[model samples]
Target: MEKYHIKLTEEEAGLLSKIDLRSYHQNHEEGRAAYLNNQEPILALLKSLSGRRAVPEVRLSYWNDPNYRSGRIKGSRKGLFERNGCTGSDIYTHPHFLEQLRYFLFGTELPDAVIEAFEAKVGNPEWVSSSDIVPIGKAARDLTRRYRLDIAAAPEEFFKLCLDMGLGLSAAESVMRSVKQVR
Candidate 1:
């Protein structure tokens, strides 16, 4: 496993500071892509800040219908997943995850156990599509609180930045696991 050091410039920091929350969410898809691509710099930022880890619960499409706002946050997996709507690839343990990990993290393929983790989550019924393994909003909030920065306030670029840096975290974790295996 190889380690890459990443940093962000003052200008880029300033650029992020000026972006508003509405605009960030409005461009969520593009923002998500950019967040995925330039992950290392954001990871660098997070490490310097030393943010907290928080698990967030997101509202899944089937779980939280607007008409049924009373039952928005569901605790059970029953009736949450639409059997008809689900495809083989849409499940969590699909091969696409390993392929993405290979492309982003290393020249070599991921270990079988890593792949198994994904497979373990597949069709579990409890698995929700709305939230990520890394809770972006809460992580951003943690960074802001610890660093005394206004990350969660507006233009919430901090949150988006956290989301963007998911790939970097994944790579770092993957490398660490691989190194442990070698030892």
Candidate 2:
């Protein structure tokens, strides 16, 4: 896998934590209200620093379905006790908002090295299981720990590296920001 070094300062880490706190609030009714109330100032700060929008609505209904694995939403077996009625629409219900949010938060462009690393990790059986289909989440976490200590690259660079190593984009971004302060 392609390797890049990255580091984060204390202030940057704090800012990323605040962003995560807001995101957590966005999931529930009360949290959503708090998130909405604080949206402008957070957006202003994120915009000034990264020139991108940070408040993106994310629906996690698919995550609630027990039968759902990886990105696939499988129909429950007839005899199964836990029947999941989740459909494809439930998984991809809000594509437009997701796309827009991703673009706004993380730029449209991914670095070439990052893409190469992703291709390498994703195609390997060691990284992706055939029966389960869930990519090895632990491996991705380990890679983040391995790379975050290097002082050569910026937090965003480390974030991209985490994504390339099989971490979800939002998760990787969160981790990247968590390690450093962003103001």
Candidate 3:
């Protein structure tokens, strides 16, 4: 796999945390156009990478999520559940937001209908039904692990990887310099 060093000032890193792509995802509920409009920054950033190499494989994990392993996905009043693959908190904030960001940036092989179902809060009575919803945990895990994710080539990708690596929003606290990818 190929990789590139990412250089970002503190300002850029903070932007990652500020980006709110998950709020409209079945949270408050917004039309597709409105949802995309609210998240223009994320879309613009992704568009900027149009000709660049696709995002490198990411090492997102589900820990030892027995539920994820057992293929038991749940949809409750709180939100969907699949072991550590996701939580109500994650869906509302942080790492899950990060994951959502990854989803938009990298795109998915999942059918457009599946993506639309996830993006919209209405329709799809299946949205509230666990049995009908595609198991996102397994799909996300499998998509993320397709390649040995050894490096990141973009600042956005790097920031996300930092959080995925458990550096959290304060990844700057530990590595104040830019990300460097090795050949």
Q: lDDT of each model, Cα atoms only?
A: 0.31, 0.38, 0.35
Decoy 2 TM-score against native: 0.24
Q: Give the TM-scores of the predictions, in the order they appear.
A: 0.18, 0.24, 0.23
Task: Give per-residue CA lDDT, model 1, range 97-155, as digits (tens).
Answer: 32222222222232334233332432232342344333333332343344444322321
| Candidate 3 wrong stretches, greater than 4 Å | 1-18, 21-36, 59-98, 102-183
Which ten residues in a row are the worst by lDDT in model 3? 61-70
What lDDT is obtained when candidate 2 is compared to the true structure?
0.38
- In candidate 3 the C-alpha lDDT for residue 52 amounts to 49
Which segments of candidate 1 are over 4 A away from where they belong?
1-129, 151-155, 159-163, 166-183
lDDT of 3 by residue, 62-176 (tens): 2222221112564331234343465533343433344544443433323334334323422332333443223422332233334333334322333433333333233311221
- Residues forming the 10-long window of minimal summed lDDT in candidate 1: 53-62
Order of candidate numbers by TM-score, starting with the best: 2, 3, 1
- Return the TM-score for candidate 1, rounded to 2 decimals: 0.18
Report how far residue 149 has shifted in candidate 3, in Å.
24
Worst 10 residues of 2 by lDDT: 53-62
lDDT of model 1 at position 107: 24
Top-lDDT structure, candidate number: 2
Quote the RMSD, in angstroms, for model 2.
14.2
Candidate 3, residue 138: the lDDT equals 32
